[model samples]
Target chain A: MRNIIIPAVLFILVITFVALNLFYITDNASRLDAILVSASDAAKNGDFEEATAEVERFKEEFSAVGKYLFAVIQHNEVDDVIFSSNRLLALCNADTKEQFLSEIEVTRESIKLIRDAEIPYLENIL
Target chain B: MAVAVIRTVILYIIIVFAVRVTGKRQIGQLSPTELVITLMLSELAVLPMEDMQKPLLAGVIPIFVLVIVEFFVSAVVLKSIRLRRILNGRPMPIIENGRINQQNMKKIKLSLDELAEELRILGSYDIETVSEAVMETNGQMSIVLKEDYEPLCKDNMKAKKEERKVPAVVISDGEIQKEGLLKAGIDKEQLKSILQKNGCSSAKEVFYMTSKAKNSYFIVKKEKKQ
Candidate 1:
């Protein structure tokens, strides 16, 4: 009886931790996606200052949750997103609208990949 | 980068503590269940360390869960012999009365040649001379030599010799061990005088010191190069 109960309880705790982490990842992914879209929109409108501000917002969100994402996902995947964000910030600073918009799109795709990776759908799992 | 380094160091300490909680068993002595837990814990701890983007909690929570589960299972197994047997499996007697128990060997899926090889490694080259051999749950063989084949010892030969006490080191690397001194039944004053007689001014001057017998001490002074 104890043998079964011990493992069963541990299994439940494991599931709970994973669920909590999934929700955390989902929340961060949405926030990142929102900021990237806003930054891209600002860049499209030729408002470099507004676009840079949006980039800063994106950076803040990434800094907050990047470490957490690392725990759940691959290092290179997170690093790729970080690298793209840094490039996005630079492009915005240099007033390179075309490059800034492209960087934002790349970063958005990376965030979506990370979010979908955590979804645990059969398609993803298989 | 600094945060990642700090997190790695903290996780390393947590892993050490977790392993300690599992008990002081050698890797080779660990049961199947213990080995699995250790492997999983190692893999889980590396996740946060390898990627700075991962939160420390991601690695920490899973590691703690494993440690807790292992501790609880170990405790439960300790209380119930039946549970221990079920989890680790009971030792099988492979050899009885200098004869190989073929049935028991078949039960554990151990071949006769492998059994002989294990016995040879254990210093029992001649299976005929081994009274019994039990295959422990950890997959090691525990052998009982026949009376006539047993090694000759002082007690067996009834030899008269001085009873030498196991020497305890009171000082090592120029540092005094208070607990070692207490176990050797000596105080600081006696140690000081002994050190002085041995051409040492203080405990710090001595490189090594041991108590072999009552009121007898061996001292080695630290060299200038050291």
Candidate 2:
């Protein structure tokens, strides 16, 4: 009885943990992408002040969940997201409109990749 | 440095617990599936211990998953004979009726030298003396000696012998063992009487003591410090 119960409880816990990780990465990635898109739009409209504030908020948000992300996601993938976000922040601060917009796309793609990898898509599994 | 130390401690505890849960099979006695799990557990634990950047959960989650899977599989395998045979290969006969099964030996990739070495280890210098020898699933050899070559016992000589209980160590290096006292069916008071009878002032004066049956004991006094 104990043998069955222990493994059963652990199986449920592991499944729950994996599900939570998938949901967390997916939700966080979408949130971060939205923030980056907002910043990119602000930069395009010549609103450097709003764009800088939004980029700062994006960094804050990423940092807030960085530890959790690192726990579930691969270190290299998480590191890539961090690197690209920092670059995006620098471009926004320098008021380089075109470069900042392109950097936003790169940052968003990296964040999305992390979430995508968590998903058990056939291509990813293969 | 602190993180590494803490992670090492945690992983040590986890790995020990995992091994304990898996059962008491020695490394050489583990089945193929068990061997794989043991290898995977060590590999998973070492990664986080060496790399502080890798989250401990990265190792822990997979370890738990593997342990759970192994546990569940073993339970299911117990109820299913086919699964058991599939996972842990059936024991093959290497030698039967004093004749070696060369075909089975070849299938298992057991060379003649290896068989000779195994037989030698089993104290069987002559293969013809063995009635049966099985190659177990865990890769150990089990040999049964032929009746003519079997060791002579009291039954063969028609001799009567008294049955005796195995002696349990009651004292070792001046320390009393409670479990040993129980095993020997003696209490502390009886132990004290036995020690007094043996001319020992106390347990500390004794280096080794064993009790067997009622009022039956063996005692060895500690040597004087040089």
Q: What is the C-alpha lDDT of each candidate?
A: 0.85, 0.86
Model 1 pairs in collision: A66-B53, A67-B53, A67-B54, A67-B55, A68-B55, A70-B53, A70-B54, A71-B54
Q: State the weakest 10-residue window (summed lDDT) of model 1 chain A.
A: A117-126
* Quality of model 2 by C-alpha lDDT: 0.86
For each candidate in turn, the TM-score is: 0.62, 0.63
Q: Where in model 2 is the C-alpha error above 4 Å? A: A1-126, B161-164, B223-225
lDDT of 2 by residue, A13-126 (tens): 866777777788789889998999899889999998999899889989998888887776567887887888888778877889989888888888888877776676534432
Candidate achieving the largest DockQ: 1
Q: Which stretches of candidate 1 lie over 4 Å from their true place?
A: A1-126, B109-117, B154-166, B199-201, B220-226
Q: For model 2, how big is the iRMS in angstroms? A: 12.4
lDDT string for model 1 (B175-226, tens) is 9998889989989998888888888999888889999888788888888863
